[model samples]
Target: MLHRHPLRHAALLIPIAILAAVSSAQKADSIHYDEHTRIFRMDAADVTYAFGVNNVEELEPVYWGRAVAANDPLPAPHTMPEASSNDSAPTVTPKEYAGWGGGLYPEPALKVTFPDGNRDLVLHYVSHKINGDELIITVKDIERAVFVDLHYSIDPATGIIGRWAVIENKTSTPIMIEAAAAATWNLPRDTDYSLRYLTGRWAGEWQLQKQAILPGETVLQSKRGSTSHQNNPWFAIERGEHPDEESGDVWFGALAWSGSWRISVEQDQLQQIRVTGGFNPFDFGYKLAPGKQLETPKFFGGYSHEGIGEASRILHRFELTKVLPQGPMPKPRPVIYNSWEATEFHVDEPGQSALAEKAASIGVERFIMDDGWFGQRKDDHAGLGDWYVNKEKFPNGLKPLIDKVHSLNMDFGLWVEPEMVNPDSDLYRKHPDWVLNFPGRPRTEGRNQLVLNLARKDVRDYVYNFLDDLLSHNQIAFLKWDYNRNWSEPGWPAVAPDDQKEVYVEYTRNLYGILAELRAKHPGVEIESCASGGGRVDLGILRYTDEVWPSDNTDAFDRLRIQDGFTYAYTPEVMMAWVTDSPGWTNNRTTSVAYRFLSSMQGSLGVGANLNKWGPEDFATAKQLIEAYKGIRETVQHGSLYRLVSPRDGSETSVTESVSSDKKQAALFTFLHSSTMNYPYPRVFLRGLDPKTTYAVTSIYGRLSKDTPTSASGSYWMSHGVDVELKGDFQTAAFRFDAK
Candidate 1:
């Protein structure tokens, strides 16, 4: 049943008209923007708030939330759930353990009573709150407890809107919680369905099934066909299967999926689970002292296809009462070239400048110099703590290279890993306590690195100032902000024992603060979010970045699946996939260069591999592809994306297309993974075309070199379909059509 609570101070709430106007106006504090949404941020007292609005709809509520907590609980051993009957509800029994400094603490205990005759899931937090718009529920002092808080809120005017859940450490001591947060939507039992999931990582198909047990043994049984398991945390289910798609409405809900964990603690320790919604999860966790808080963030639309799509549309409606005084919004980012895989950690001023010159020579507008330019950064083992230019590598310094790039008419970009620290670095040497660590415990390390405790003001200040200093000193046009790894040795010496689980949430909040500050100061610089590859590619970070490095693996085949999975929650424009050389960096798979270039064009196009090694013919091919991309840049960058083929179907080929909003132009790409005998020239169907308009088709690539205008009724294109022929191994064919 729907619950209705009257606004405590309805008169004080901002008027709808004013809120709409404010939402539409671009604010200086806005960090990220798209054709549909804008994000405005502010600091209220100690908490930082990110207010997001969908500028297209004035009636839409603002999407706002904060990270308000940071703490690590005492560690405890975790026991996996024994196989149980499907009819029985899972029971959690908490045991105590020793605290961080060797003091005895209560074992974590939890009892989830799915009482009869009740639809509301009663999550009894040892501590709970009812006042704020958002709350972060967390568990402290325990490492193995699976603690999560679900916050539900609704505005009478907005209906059943936003909801967010904060998952925390449930063990008495430290334990690594490796899980992806997911929400599975449940459609009506009679609904027709199909499922889609990322292959390789997990294997599964989305065809109609009577029953299915996901990776974590989450049973999703349907009486009739239902799309109820869409966003759940799925791991090794089955591999090499395509995600299923269907032709009916589907329902949705969220799920928190976990990986394995190593918990360390004694018995009898008390662990805390806290929850907060709305603003920041870390900040909310901080406000509550060893208890759960039920605060709401801003509105979180819903889980249905229509609901999610509507949320994006409505995000444009909210306005900011206050905005930082930045100038007009920056122009849409250009198709740039990134020197990451090409150089890795070997980049120096001269090398980078040379690469930049070569890139500029080929009409490459932006030259991004990837990692290895800071501190004594060599391998992944050390030198992350200090954020200084390596004079030994950049003898002439970055300014000259940036100046040279500008002289060559290209923008300069740099990479930074601010949230991590290497044990051997100067910063770590000067302040051993700066990294996240318990006073006397052996700190765990991942990739020979440690996570900086952003919960501490000193650490936050240092990171913020370091970035500010770098941006101030350099004429860097873009910042490729990367979070290469996840959290390990999760400890916050600065926070009290009772509030340690809040550290994770706090770390993320502080990150938001740093990004907010940077955007405010450097309004013209574009930020590209990168996480080891696609690890941190999510809507949450999208609010701060212009684009995201879709993955470190730019092989066209791999991206076919990666980009397909990404589209479930993200827009096509935000995904940054690139065309690189083959043999690929790792697989050494030599795909057709045309196939490689065409796949990357689906997102923000970039060249990641060395271009200097190309032969004359290859250079001509590269030039041709670049020219073709430039010709349709607008349509590809801004047009509607339609999935024409499934990568998961184990198909030997895949196809995708982008059609202009005016329906006057369309770009279609068909990829052939391997050779097929007497290959059926699959007449690829088209989407988003105007049947009413006659169109001309020209083979941008392949043997069909003539431009031909073919009359196609819009209704026929939709009902019947257009076809294209393909043959051979590692092949690609593209066609561009415009109204005659």
Candidate 2:
């Protein structure tokens, strides 16, 4: 049953459309079967992702990348080193999408503990069909009526294959699914592999870590019940040595799950390797009753033979054209001015009005009133779950601030943490049972807040009603949706004893449902996903949001690397980077205003500094910088990104270039962290430029240290490169190029 209430002012639901199937499966872009060998070949753009059923009726991978002419390439005769002589026959080899009952030591891709106490499940091919752009293959357990259907789909343009599974209990008995994954992707075993994944802490998220994929199961996961900041649910494998940002044959995959998830990369003793991803089993289990089914999240992967750069471009193109809201083309992100740093929790109508006026005087396109506008929320501990305006702060309601902001030619936005409640809030006081808790158990609290059980019908209804009413009553154009804490002691008491574990997954599902409903009601409003900051940012959350707060630490220097890690898996278009006060309260490093603006301009830019404290010079400089950013915003937001010099390489200078979609314009940013005693800077070779074209380059705002050539041939820029010189610490520069 769909959980939806009659929306007071709902519009025609603009259905989220899925990619249509290819004209014909037998055509060049899809599944083609070899009748003699029973081999299935799935062709993507420049790659071929194929798999076949072996003699034992288990799925085995044939090839995964750059199309080759070989047909039915089977494994050569080999003996297993991890098994005894009796069990060493090559006939018992581990299979792709391997299940239990096979002589498998590495984590099985699918593990379901049945009610009959038999954990072994040997799957045999049952049927195959192609419906539109997707190919569905059904497999059944040998002795049971359980059916597992595998879905394989590809977007022809990017060659990104989306894979997932559905496990159905066709029997009359209940099945306990402890460990079920979407799919396992197998890569060739002939080369040494290096694994790359993201990891970091609270205010510091998306720190990329790369190491050799040894002969063991290496897991990159998030068990915090949300896509945790500590580990991201994405992985990439490169051959032999660590590949630079621009070059290497890279295979990568990411899970489209907002809740607890895991991705395991395993290289067996015999050098065979596979990567499987899905829900994390920590504090998780689902009971599928008779005739019921369990569907897993989509695990999307792509191959980039050109290296990590092409990999990023592929993911970026797919996300831009398909996944993100306002599909195919993204709405241009506004230049935002947030009130959090200026007036953290001490919100008043007059103060915000003044800020709005100042914000408009400069060039802020959006004015966001962050936390403290809602009921009794003077601090973090109280007044959550109360959606009404705090009468004390905004005596009349948000209209006064909203009208003032709107009159200034800027859109108004607000911050909300709808899924949380404080003990002191009236909503929680009236409905304490609406939260996640086990009977008679101590409820664990983080940030003086408790997680509202959205998995419950009542709780979800309350959240949806408040959010819908807020949008209905206000002229809010955007919402900064924040999840401040992770789930601890997650339990749903109203649920049946054996089904409480479903809360881990159901909460995220309901959250998405509410977002969809809210969007359906108010099509004009956009959302930004924030967690204690960056904790819940992922492909899954990105689906519903227009932007994401990459981290709480907006100090431009630390952000260099943090943003690097984030862009490695996500596109910069959705990365909401901000220019904040410095010696940033978060990092205690002082930098010039120009340095801050240039760093933040690499993506969707925002300003979080206390503008009221700024002098006339600051305002003037800010206005100039904002105007300059606007001039090239589209190119930077939609352009192809090239990380010319990495901040992670322990270099004093970090450079990046973004060539526009039409190749007519490009924006380049350079940061000199610090300078040595009169040492000349390195010449930076630019990428993604046409060698035959001549370009007109100029600096924006003219705030940098040196002058670059007014015009240069693209061949000269690509070959001889440009030299950027700076003298002081935290100094930055930005230059724009026009193809002429």
Candidate 3:
């Protein structure tokens, strides 16, 4: 219920404009196909991927690893020889995309049943075409009219490939498609590979988890109708057992869907690893009539030979330059002040106006009034679907508060949960059939709210029209769009029973359409994606939203671990970290104001603490730290991250560094849990700097060691690291270096 901070890509082609940044030599030959060998190869950054059509007419993975020359020798395409009677050629050979028939059974890429009770389906290559940076391959079933088109594209800067599929039913009868996948990724046969992913619950999302890649299947999925926080749709496979932060081979990928999705990592009898992911198959059946078609969400995969740290850096660069809004170079995240904790559901114009003035004094650029601003919402149990300003709370509507924030030199934002409705609300009373429900089943409720059935065209239009009117009438600059609960009784009675399962895909598609329409209508307004703290986060949603709330657990010490795990899959440019009160709401632990500010400054900085309770000393400290953060905001938000020291495995210290794209500025943050056994913190060596250039160092907090130099060459700083003295429990320090 209100436990804490409530309210809490598209096939994305690498734009041709980005090629100007790459070397001419490297850009000349990025993708190639050899007709003689029936093989295709692509190169981006420092990695390469290759595949070929074998004699049996199946696409087989040839090689995938570090970059190789165009003329490098590779194996010719051929069918694998079966070892035993039990291991047939279909099971032994690694097909890039396979159907669910012909005695093949390692998680089929496509499965369907005919109206005539014939389920056997096998696919073979029909044709191929390459247009500049993208490739399209068409395949069809051996004796049926079902066809599938596979799409692929790679980002030149990050070496990450985007994949998706389009399935078309060309037959005259309705076909029941049971399962489908966007793509299947194959890795070389190796026994030492380990899978790394993120997992946690409500208040504990984004916890880094790892396990050995054994002989069976490891399924990671979310059947909660939204992207549940139980398991994020991202993965990394390490080739060796001793891979560290900065030095080993790492392959990573992420799914782009926000609705019910799955990723199956299976090791077959031949010891090869395969990853098949797309829409989840549980309780799923899509009826494809006559000539209708369906498109899968994009899947992205990448490689980094230098290690997991470099893998994250590649993803960060790709997201900032290609995936985000206003790309090639998007604007920096403005410092925000959210009043969720300050005023909670008791928000009034006068209280928010006061908070706005204090927030402006500390350099907050955007002022967000969370929760109780509308719809008789004094608490979480009622008035969710009714999106009107409460007469008792705001006599003159939101304009008075919006104008007040603007006068204080800050923009105004509001919180809204458009996908939920409470049973006690007027909207629910008038339209009882508007939500997802079965005709004769108990509708389960979470957070005292029912999920709106966006799959229905009427319901979808209603949510869009209300939000469009809200923005059109107000002077709002941002919207904190939140989804606080998962779906239950996910049934769409408006459609036929055979198409009811299409709710999973249609609901998410309509949500995206609303966001895209609103964005086109109001170009000045930005949006944030929040779902009970990171429940609906994925590449599919990020294309339309600006920032994300990682977790509701804002404890400074605990965030060091949570934020560390988040960066493995997502860039810090969109990570919104807040600094709340001392006795944390989650853990009841007290930490100094300086420690809290430093922790939040690592990402897009925001202040959510109750300013009314803060004294003069606290305000002064906040203003000074915020000013320092602005100076390094460029490097931290748009630079290369070097996770020098991890916060896992009970380590006493944590360290991270960020270097600007131009290699001219760098920021370093160090944290200490305790000074045990009288041992000093480790010396910090910097990375991603121009060795020949000289830099001047400045400390934002803590004292530098006596031997530390104020000015030195980049090589000297990299080889002979600087040191800072941090003692006691829950201490932190920050340093900034500028090129001279």
Candidate 4:
């Protein structure tokens, strides 16, 4: 639900009077319907979306683009002209929600098969209701008892609309749903749009890919039983090839799903672009029983005429205020320190206490003890499903370590990978059938562990009970929940063969339910979702998680690109960026301490470096840098991000600026890969600031040009810009601006 704001009430007070001339005035940001014209117009922020019933009684898209005044004339609904006998009305017309029948050629919103072998299904508008910010439109099959309810809700703060559909089977026989989509969005005919999406592998995820939209279809999907790192469930379409960071019309969206999902961007025969996304149909089959219903995941979409950067800022605000758990007034993300880099699986009570002291000395707010603390988990080969503490490592259990961390003024967090089970663990030995596998088939293993079948009731209960008990016994304040592998040999022999395909949906549902229950039971504890890294980060998982590990590769240099592409769809509030050791583990590229810390401080800061190997200078530098970060963490986590200089295009420098919501505080970060021919950094301009307000600037790190002013008006900063004085390999700089 959207948080309460003045615009929310303004959206409710839509003028009902019909104007006869063009001189009439009406309030913006409203949703209204015209009975005579059979049109439904929704004005969200600066954009407008409308749809209505056509002459043939089918729902068709009317317009979706820049906002228009209420008195503006809109054409009455009419079916599109048919091209020929080969191109029927259903094929040419852009439908709001189309079924798989009546010679339809595009992607159908809903497809089903009857028990009597009849496949023809057509949907016609039945009824609609407007309640608060939501609009529900119901349609039914022409000659059957099947029904579909279309849901639309708009966020006043961001102009983003959430769309989904619920299908009901009211017939006496079961209906097999062959494929289902949340909603289909259509663009105007013959628009030159270029598609931009993210694609990458395990250690190298979130690489932005751009291509021109062709006549056929471009399918971006994940069939790995989870939101894979191969392709994220997000997309942005630019109106032309010349669109840049600051100017152009762009349309963007993201799906709120964690399971196997698919999004198809297709240009139809009439050259109309449409986006249809929902659960992947690769191995999808849902048998809806009589009187049962199925609801699809929500797909959110928005429009921005300012550019792709503004589109991202809009999504970022929507997520921080409406999508997250503690939105609108969320607590700041704590500066955390994880022990995995320090000792890995060799954690003990004294060693942990010593590390806690070092961490507390540097102002770490949360201490997370990563893997190898429980079961027989001395290595990746064993102790996954077993959730018990290691008796030999901690003779007095985790209480002493937890108590020690608590005494040092920090909350304690533990790492657990509950979805996986090693064959050498006691849990797997006792319940050999718990893992997902075909009967008598060889169970595939990743990281030497098999995925537990959370689709089964017994397995779900066991996993939940153990976690609940662990939290109930300890004073744990956070959990770094990790899932290390993808699904392989996914089978549930306990269920019937026809119903086995339900694992994809049921497993995700159970996982969400468990997280919901845990939050309800322990309201004070926070959770971070990590599937290896960036594997399961999506809107569905973000609803329960307080933060996310974006990637396993913490190399500061590589992360400049990784984190740059990440902010395109997600806010930095939930992105956990850690400062690891120099000579990075992934690329062996060493960066200075200031560079690494500043790179991580761009997002939620964390320290995963081995403190035991640090010299006094390292400790001193960390303490000072972290203090500077704390002064601006609020603005960094809940501010409008401006990508001044992108790290893409093989540029030698990268720059970003974050301005607070009130425009009073701003943080500027600059990085240089290497100096060449005595060249200086680019002139960086600040955005999202009040032009009339005067601001004072101070250096957080590095130095500015000798002639730079100490204070200036916001307009001066935007026009004249700032300059950095640096001449070295792997250099960094940061500055803070406070409104005077």
Candidate 5:
């Protein structure tokens, strides 16, 4: 429905000149074209777009004409293009790509080529209009080494922009790139603005302060850490959508280093514009021994006028696309109960069956058989390499145990730490080369285990097949894929010393490939990623799993902090925080049952305690909590979540609440950190409630001396408040409401 503005006379020459210059340049090696495919390959690299057609032939010329004929008034030319006559360095031109009317969808593609006469790099851009308002930009012939591709996309409907970057290591050597990519926006010079970065422990280094700029515009910046071959760093920027704002300008910049090849991006021209300086792609003189490649961790960034909160929502929507099916897949709720804390390392057929029995009794839907289910895996220090199920633990094999759980009307799950092998195991003894180690150096071990060298094709193939075989043998509804440790003594016998860092990034890529393959083969099975808890919880891993174990420390009190920190980057659905018994195994904090259940309800509600020991009262309370959780599952899972009170203030109490999408109903949970001897009372304010709606409040557990149900409209509850008194070591209460 959208139409481009008619070109004026002055812009006619622009397209002619640009096309002539492009024709004079060397012809690209490959050309691909298709209407349905937004991605095109030219020089061994893939270009992804938010929207576009597949055909390059049909797209290039049209987009070229538009770019050359773009009639948007240009800001004064800042600097003259550096001359090519200088023998000391290559000349460069700074170009500004503009997005106007909020629908200038930008699609970027990449290709690498070695120019005939020069080793220096020159990138070429081609644009396409495959769909309404969807623009594609393809850059060909960029010299490849270890470079990060930073690109941004804007959603036409929402006026929200999403940023994404990919690191392609064309060379075989590994490089340690520790840097952050930032997006800086230029505001109107006279505008006074308040800059704020979302606060949370996981919100990497961020700063906000006011400063004067030239008579042009103010600058807003958001920066976050880089991706090694091991990790990916990403950040997002939001420009609170106000009534007066006209256009939002965003520039993607990165600071990186490859040995001495350091580059940094800085705000320039007093906020009118910014630039990335200090680029030295050739400083290291590094080459990936033929047949090997390493890439910097990719970064995602964008600019939006929808405030930080809505910007987060848009970011999640983009991230969800990478993991969710293009078509509809079963929206299976991952309501799972893990046996690690309940059974620990002492798992057996009878124990698993008993646990499953207890789990089903309390409305548990998925029973995950955690560690100690495989090959003499009696303790954490041994039996890791051996992947076979221990017959002693399961007399008739795991099939019987899994069948038993399913017979009780619950899906069965299994855990595997595939990338690690314990030294005292059969596989390690048979193929010592499976473990990554230096030829003559001592291989360091953690938890009596060593990481598999995924860099080698043989190792990757072995691990991939092992997992495929395991999944094929069992009807696993889900897999608790745990990476229990971090990379240590980082070395690979198969890689040269100079390229050691490449192992980290390559290992992750191999992991992604393996996961991609597994997902394709067994589309029904769901995977839960756990890296000793939140260590590996990032957008990259979220691309592979349905959920993540927020932390191994699930004690209700600890999870208050854990879940609070997790929500900054991830949603509540993805945070698999649970409630378990206390004196807890780790902290020994004997929290009240209600308190534990309330904390667990904030995430995927699951139980990780010895349910067999629960008394009648405990059983009744657990049943009620489970039913209540199921009733509000959708609202809690998909609604907007806000943290009202934090437990980190050393206060004796904390509270959290979730409101329904329609704002018709709200759930409030309050926790008491310690028992109060006299006049113990806690008053809490409810959030996200509809003032017009009236509601009934009641205690989910048995009545306390001072506790009683009360009815109040949302306005009354918000103004007058609700209060509950507790006389126990730990306490919790829940309230529900409905539209009047």
Candidate 6:
């Protein structure tokens, strides 16, 4: 029933101080491991991840779910009396840190290949250290001078465990690391295994895939030298017992690395699952010299008993407060306009100025001129490494376009591929040796560009200086830092033979350093990490960039699924969604402007459509939608998100809701892929709202039929959902609800 209140709707809205505090001030021995008992307990909000070490000195997982002690830790295989032999006994092959040892461990967490080709790694617990909010457990090889230290940092308030492993070379001889995983997460074997990961190629990225953790090993990796579009460094494990998103003990983990990475989910014969992740060990070996140490990227994971949405919320909160450069509470992302879709490579000062004017007309806050404003960059084939503006395109340099953009009250952003070089360009001709390649080896070219050897100090300085000069000379507020290709020959002839392999890790490190330097120099400038569309999006990159373009595909229909998969491990704030032309270049799928607008609104909305081609009606609709989006932008960007419906389920409808941190404002986005005959749109149950509070709903998209309640209790709206009978292809709607 609708609640009729005489007072204005604003009178009912109150700051959600209590909810905000709980979300922000949540505590850190919520996770504790006793030395005597050898038991580790990690508590997050409502769930607990517990594990214990057995008598054999092998770390084993105990339980992961709602709070409770692990019932009798698994017995050591050596002590079991079932006529204990090399096999036949109930052996736990999946250890907390798998290594080459007794009882066939399928996936090894630590594998070191010595000069003699010996891959024996037997690490036993040596000691432990407690330093305030973190625990460092050290283990050393039994036969070699190698020590591995596992560091676990727990944020008591959020219950997020930031875990990483450090392999220290204590031997005089340089040790060749065949494979060194960052962390091995052991999940409970009680429920049937189901693994969810994102996979795609090129234009189609973040295509979510879920299946049973089959026998042997299912490795999800990106060996293309970059974090390739084929696989993302994130995973979500859902036990069969609780398969659905809203009702499961969903265990999730992500590798905080932007370079080549891999995650192996090994399910042995017994159905036990052991997931290990870190730098991809294929064609990659880190050589550690005497007294040198190699620290793996932080691989963090958490358990959520409430469901996948809760798991995502926990991750979002952790990312916002811990991972990102801007700490804790972040400002709402502004509406951006990218000139690539509108102008393509034919960008000019006057051409971009016209687009910027059109962009500002529709409430675009950031005007980004992507590509072709620089040297000989008429197309993708040339002028990549050249950072200077094209005299032919921008006769007076980028200042004119930037100034015009700023004149329209929009922040100016430029696109630069600092890590790439055209094989036929002036920069490449000047420093042919600057590109990454082994001597006498044929270099592989991608997008008609070669990867720059940022690992080299000279190359890094050249690139940094040009970028710094560009930003300093122009009034650029943001930079779209793009890396279009991956490493080919994987070499650094400039460095020592042993130091050559360090290029893989050093390149990413130097890239981050450059970004940090740029930001430090220009405090007000923001950066977006774009690598052929989401290829380099990771916690490692997010620390530098303000946002990430998930993919090249802008089809509204396809974006729903991609955005959904992206949010599984990443928050929407970093997701840059664009509304392009009806027939998107990637999918060639035509969708209504409303559908496109609502779809993109789920994240940081951007308009990439050609304003010159838009009809009067299209512009009017876009202007209206842009204005409507601004009203709920803050709530959507920094709120608790609820995934009420899934497009992956093959259903006709998809739904989502976001509630402001204060719980005073909520925005709901719903989409109907295609309506069927006699099949009405089902009642949409609302979520992420205070059940006792009453909310006044106003339509931001579609019209609500008569007899529909204008306002209702949150409980009523959630329990007795609103039903719409709209029949159409690509039907979409949004509503703004204010607590009254």
User: What is the C-alpha local distance difference test score of candidate 4?
Assistant: 0.88
TM-scores of all candidate predictions against the true structure? 0.66, 0.93, 0.96, 0.96, 0.70, 0.91
lDDT per residue for candidate 6 within 479-564, as digits (tens), equals: 88888877788888987886687777888888888988988998888888888887888888888888888988788988898888
lDDT of each: 0.51, 0.82, 0.88, 0.88, 0.53, 0.80
| Candidate 3, superposed: residue stretches over 4 Å from native | 1-29
lDDT of 1 by residue, 483-557 (tens): 755655566766676466556556666776788889889987778877666555433455567776656667677
Candidate number with the higher TM-score (5 or 6): 6
Clash list (residue pairs), candidate 2: 21-132, 21-133, 248-307
The local lDDT score (0 to 100) that residue 329 gets in candidate 1 is: 31
**Residue 289 local lDDT, model 2:** 95
Ranking by TM-score: 4, 3, 2, 6, 5, 1
lDDT of 2 at 354: 93
Q: Write model 5 residue lDDT over 361-440, tens digit each, in one string.
A: 87889998889988988899888868888888887888998889999889899999988999889889898887767677
Native-to-model Cα distance after best TM-score fit, residue 491 in candidate 6, in Å: 2.6
Which of 5 and 6 is the better model by lDDT?
6
- The candidate with the higher TM-score, 2 or 4, is 4
- Give the runs in model 1 whose Cα sits over 4 Å from its true position: 1-161, 164-246, 252-331, 703-723
TM-score, candidate number 4: 0.96
lDDT of 5 at 545: 76
Go through the candidates in order and give the clash count of each. Answer: 128, 3, 0, 0, 13, 6
